[model samples]
Target: MYENMDKEYVLNTYPRNYVNFKQGKNATLFDDKGKDYIDFTSGIGVSSVGHGNARLADALSDQVHNLIHTSNLFLIEPQAKLAKKIAELSGFDVGTFFANSGAEANEGAIKLARMYGEKKFKNKRYKVITLEHSFHGRTITTVKATGQDSFHKSDFSPYPDGFSYNKDINDIYNSIDDETVAVMIELVQGEGGVEPFEKEEVQKLAAFLKSKEILLIVDEVQTGVFRSGEFLATNLYGIEPDIITLAKGLGGGVPIGAVLTIHKDIFEVGDHGSTFGGNFLSTRAGCEVLDILEGYKNSGELDESFIYFESKLQEIAKAYPALFEKVVGLGLMRGLRCFENVDLSTLINRAFDQGVLILKAGRNTLRLLPPLTISKEEIDEGFKRLDNAFKVLS
Candidate 1:
């Protein structure tokens, strides 16, 4: 009934599955019909901690009872606390602006980058360099920034210029001109399939960009919040990015986005703002998420979880070599690259049918991003279901 209602009233934007998930706990989701499905996608990496998280729920509940929202004009405590926490965790003296989604975070990053470039360079250094198969957002400017041709539809004609696509470092270096201000990249291209950049390559790029005064913006929307076994993916590469955009898992499940301006005061007064961003509720949630993740990290639970998840994925990859050609990803954010002959679409459908949720990416890849708080037992069960699903395909 809700699915039909969605089709009739809601905008036909996302190509969605027919499952009506009613509730979830830890790493499992239950559809409206009461069938349980192991959530390997984590709602596309948004549910970092987990679903129905007691800590987050309790914190938000208390927050809602006390205060819900005010505005950017006034001082908000949760927002302040979250900003401080993020700045400290980010490993940089940073200023943070909050928004409501990953797209908004990326948009803010782009704006700050453009402003900084023009101010420092004394020219219109507004052009940005993104990579092929990169997806920034659905907004007009961000979609234009996206490198995929499928997203550049004729419907949204007259695209905003100053964005270019490059495949490799040579192409990026060659493409960088006087007008180019920044090169935005995802350390692990989550949506482009779970592809991670070489650590040395990223360091080289950072060094070159620093030499040329081109800011490096790291989009940690899908890969942040311990998704890649680190606080930020940039930490894995040992690079200090000029700007970092975060959403998805920052608030665990709340709709919140953050743009951290590191190394300097980039955005001045009246530069950029958001209405409902960093509200009382979302900030409380974000604080709880940080506390929870920090607790896990201190107890050595985070490290153990990362290692265990990778081993489980390795087990599956070895079990079904033909179906899962290789396990490719950073930490818990992983993918199973399917062989050419494997029925990718059918396997996805079968996984759903077998009560295991998953996602697809790239040409033929099974993207797996389970909750950071997911238990080893849940991982085993999820894979047990996946193994059965693969057998059906065989």
Candidate 2:
């Protein structure tokens, strides 16, 4: 029916890769035609706990029964509780400003850095250094902050001047003479392809920037909330970033974002605001998701699962060296780097045909963001579909 309806509907937008999806549970999705598929992409890293988690559904439903929303004008209990929990998890004894999406979180982080620069440093530095092959968001300022030149096409010029991109550590050092305020980086550059920066390089840059007293902003939209085997990927680097941006999996399946700062002194009141951010419903969702993840951490079950899952991926990469070049990334956020001249979109379509949903990153990388609750059986099934896809492509 959807295929038929599309015939009459305008195709102004680019064609979608998938034709249909009827329903889903955990790490499986069913199409309108009744084919079942293992879901490896996890809605591009949004469904962290998995599809239709009963706990999340029950929490959301229970909240709807009592209170769905109250304006930010009035103090909300759920929002406060969630904020305290997030602050505790972030290792920051500071306040949080919430938003509805990752872009808003990034925007808020950018604003906070600029304010920190203005108030603390007397506005000596206002430029932000974002790394090349990074993806921020589609908003005007974020698109400009994004380092990919391809994204600059189609009237993205007149961009905010403070944002610039750099390639090497020295290049970044050169970019920050006196005008640079903050250096924002993604531990794992998700949309730019699943490229994890070298640890030594990152540590060197962080040390230099910290000596300069510049704010280090880590974009954890895709790496935070235990998706990378830690609450925040920064914990792995052992570096203390000044500001961090979070979204995607914070609220389980709900829309929520947060801008966290290590020092609360950077902002006075009236520095920023959000209408629907940290309201009753969204904050409740975030609190519940965090609670669930914390339970996993205590049980050590998640750690075991991820260790096994990542090992399996490495084994698969070794088996198919011709097609699967290397498995990049940590924990559940993995990228299967394919050989050159191979089209991952076509390969993903073939996987879908064989009953598995996946996503692509960069040009030749097949990104996999399976739900945290996915079982070993499901992982094996998804890889079977991937193997089939490789066969078809070959």
Candidate 3:
């Protein structure tokens, strides 16, 4: 079916880069004409357990029958279960706030950081320092928080003033004066092309923030939910972040996000709240996703998967050194850097035509965020498609 109807009906801001998706299952999607493509994008890091998982379907169906949205004014069972499970699984001091998306969770974290500063420092600290090239979300405040200045707009004018960015550890340290409330970072910068911070640099900066009594907030919105082999990417570094934000896979195919704080005293009723943050439906999906993670954790399947996946990716990277600058990332959330002057748009389109979906980040980096439940057969098929895409590029 022709999609020109979309041009008449929808807003033109999105750039509609591809055809409309008809249906998806596991790691594949079909278009209107029944053309199928391997979904390496994984809904940009959502869909952890894969598309059309029977368990997630059942959970959502059951919740649809029981309850959907109740005002946060009353207790909800699925929300409580999810909260408890996240706290237990995350090893935090046991505080969780739910939200509908990554940006909302990030907004919650920003508010919590400011509130913590107000309560502990008597309102002396309020600034948050982020790094250059970091991508948080699209909300006004998060857009301001994003390190890329291109996200700022004229009408969005007078962007939030407290957030700042620095290029190096020394600058980041020197920039943090008495008013700095928090330092937020992604251990592996995802949208910035899977740029992993140096362990030594992160350690030094973390130590400085701790010394200044500033909160360390890790934005794991793209790196969390076991996408990087660990439950949270921050765990790999052994740094104790005061606040951690999560989305993108927390509820499998469903939308959900959360902020987990180390201490519970920072937020008071009315200090922060969301109307549809912890709806029964999303919470039920979250609980089922947690159950899936729990099973994978106990059975040692995730460990094996990570081991096999990493080795395979590395092998492919080595084979095509001339075409790629490097392959960098943890586990399934990986990036491929093309040699300078390579047109990534052309390559991505070629991959799509050849039945593989890929994403671009930064300037010359191609990103792959496949579902955790993707099979070896899917990987082989996707790789072959990517190889064909590269052939066109070459």
Note the residue pairs that clash in candidate 2. none
Residues 131-163, candidate 1, lDDT per residue (tens digit)?
Answer: 987888989999998888999999998999899
Q: For each candidate in turn, give its C-alpha RMSD to the true structure in angstroms.
A: 1.2, 1.9, 1.7
The numbered model that scores best in lDDT is: 1
TM-score of each: 0.97, 0.95, 0.95
- How far residue 300's Cα lies from its native spot in candidate 3, in Å, is 3.1
Model 3 lDDT tens row, 14-109: 856658788888888888889988998898999888888888999899889989998799998999999998877777666899998999989999
Candidate 1 wrongly placed segments (more than 4 Å): none
lDDT of 2 by residue, 1-394 (tens): 6666776685746556545777878898887878888998888898888888899999999999999888888988988898899878867676788899999999999998888778777556788999888998878888888889888876756778789899745688877867788999999999977888877888888898889899899999999999888888888777778888999989987999998887788777788888888888999999999999889877997898798888878877887777777889887889889888677878788888788888888847989898888888898888887787667555
Go through the candidates in order and give the clash count of each: 0, 0, 0
Looking at model 3, how many pairs of residues clash? 0
| Candidate 2 ranges beyond 4 A from true positions | 2-14
Arranged by TM-score with the best first, the candidates are 1, 3, 2
lDDT of each: 0.88, 0.85, 0.85
